[model samples]
Target: MPDTSRTQLKQILATRYAYLVRRLERITGSKEGATDALHETWLRLDKANVSTQVANADAYILGMASNVAIDQHRHERRHAHDDDVDVLLGVPDELADPERILTARRKIDSLKDVLRGLTPRRRAILLAARVDGQLNREIAERFGISLRLVESELSAAMKYCLQRMQEAGDPYTDSRSSGPRKF
Candidate 1:
């Protein structure tokens, strides 16, 4: 790629970094998987042939990230580490020990408790904005509420959840803040 094109690509990448990561997470179903996919996409972008004037750098990166995610998924499926016997028996080759499972269950229960503690509308808004990837305007329209209300509820819900997570010793807590970050 030409120097100007590379610079442009870098700018696009910087601006769309969070959005791309969220998209990869939605596709791959895990933060680690998303990170791996992003790294692969970056590598591909660095080596991409751009001999012609490109249209829409954001779309190009999104397409590349999607392709990388698909390739990663295929590779994982083909080289699955689980033993053939395990697969035939419909069992995992290895499972977390009972203690780990119990701990995870406890953490999930704590998270649920925190969520249930929120007002119903706030909880719904949080789920819509975070889990369903709905914009504030979309959520406001869907709920027949004002955009400012949607934004306020979402912010409050996030802060409450982060506080709860911090109280529960969640590793996601940010050092600079009193609680976990807004995802």
Candidate 2:
């Protein structure tokens, strides 16, 4: 890519960084959880041939950003050394393979559309609890709702997520299927 186009891509990423971060945070569940993932994503996007799509620049960027985030998460889980205590406690090693990243991006994109059918609050609450590591009381406080409401909303939200994941063949149903996965 040309220098100017690379600068343009940087500008787009810097401007839209927060939006991308928040979405990834919802998925990864923590601000730090997605920082590296997103940074790696930017590096990949900058290297790709996206300069011709200036007509829908933002969409292209967001698509690339989302894909980058998913690939990072998948890599963290798939690494053979992730089970090692020291490595596990440290940052998850990043995946630099384009093909692996592309595959992860496609699968995650499919799930993203499925997740969109949920109400904003429902999505927020579930992601906050499951991904962001927030407790029910914390979620309630964050949303300015009562604890009882968080409990109930989470109950319904978990059920909905479980059903959706089941239909989508998401690993979430197979893994966390005991507590939060209960439908």
Candidate 3:
């Protein structure tokens, strides 16, 4: 009985090979992948024991092909080919150069110096607004000051840092006639 069913499926597959391939191509998006999936489907049908009859052989065959294609895609993703490794190796390193790293470190140190130079209350206000991510109203309430005072302190602190950074030749400073640093 199973042999009879397998034979019937094989006959249907052979008769509708082109139609099945077209449908599979639409599902897999690649002609070669679709063809391979169909071939795998054929091999599976040979091995499979169909105890019950399939009501719609065409749809069953297409579903089997789709499953095979999905399995192939997952297997390919899990096992990287040599070309993939070579491509990864060919990619340029994106890390900053030593000069850029040094400049960044210097900028950080300059910022720290500027922050240290501020009055303790101003420094605390700047840290609360910037580092602590507190709202202006929240900061004002916490410090027992008016919202206007909080805003004024934050603005002054920012302006002072900008002036100090410009004096220290910060590449990012707009004060330079050459414009902000490219990097």
Candidate No. with top lDDT: 3
Instruction: List TM-scores for all candidates, in order.
Output: 0.44, 0.40, 0.47
Model 3, 28-133: lDDT tens per residue?
9999999999999999998876589888999989998999999999998889889989999999877778987998898999999999999999999999877888
Angstrom error of the Cα, residue 160, model 2: value is 1.5
lDDT of 1: 0.81
Q: Clashing residue pairs, candidate 3?
A: none
Off by over 4 Å in 1: 1-95, 175-183
What RMSD value applies to candidate 3? 14.1
Q: lDDT of each prediction vs. the true structure?
A: 0.81, 0.73, 0.88
lDDT of 2 by residue, 1-183 (tens): 666776777787788888877866776778886677668767886577643536555666666766777777688778857358676678665775788789788677866775687888988888898788888888887899998898888778767766876787765466454654321
- 10 residues in a row with least lDDT, candidate 1: 174-183
The CA lDDT at 146 in model 3 is 93
Pairs of colliding residues, candidate 2:
29-131, 29-132
Q: How would the candidate models be sorted by lDDT, starting from the highest? A: 3, 1, 2
Error of 3 at 17 (Å): 0.6
Predicted model with the maximum TM-score: 3
Sorted on TM-score, highest at the top, how do the candidates line up? 3, 1, 2
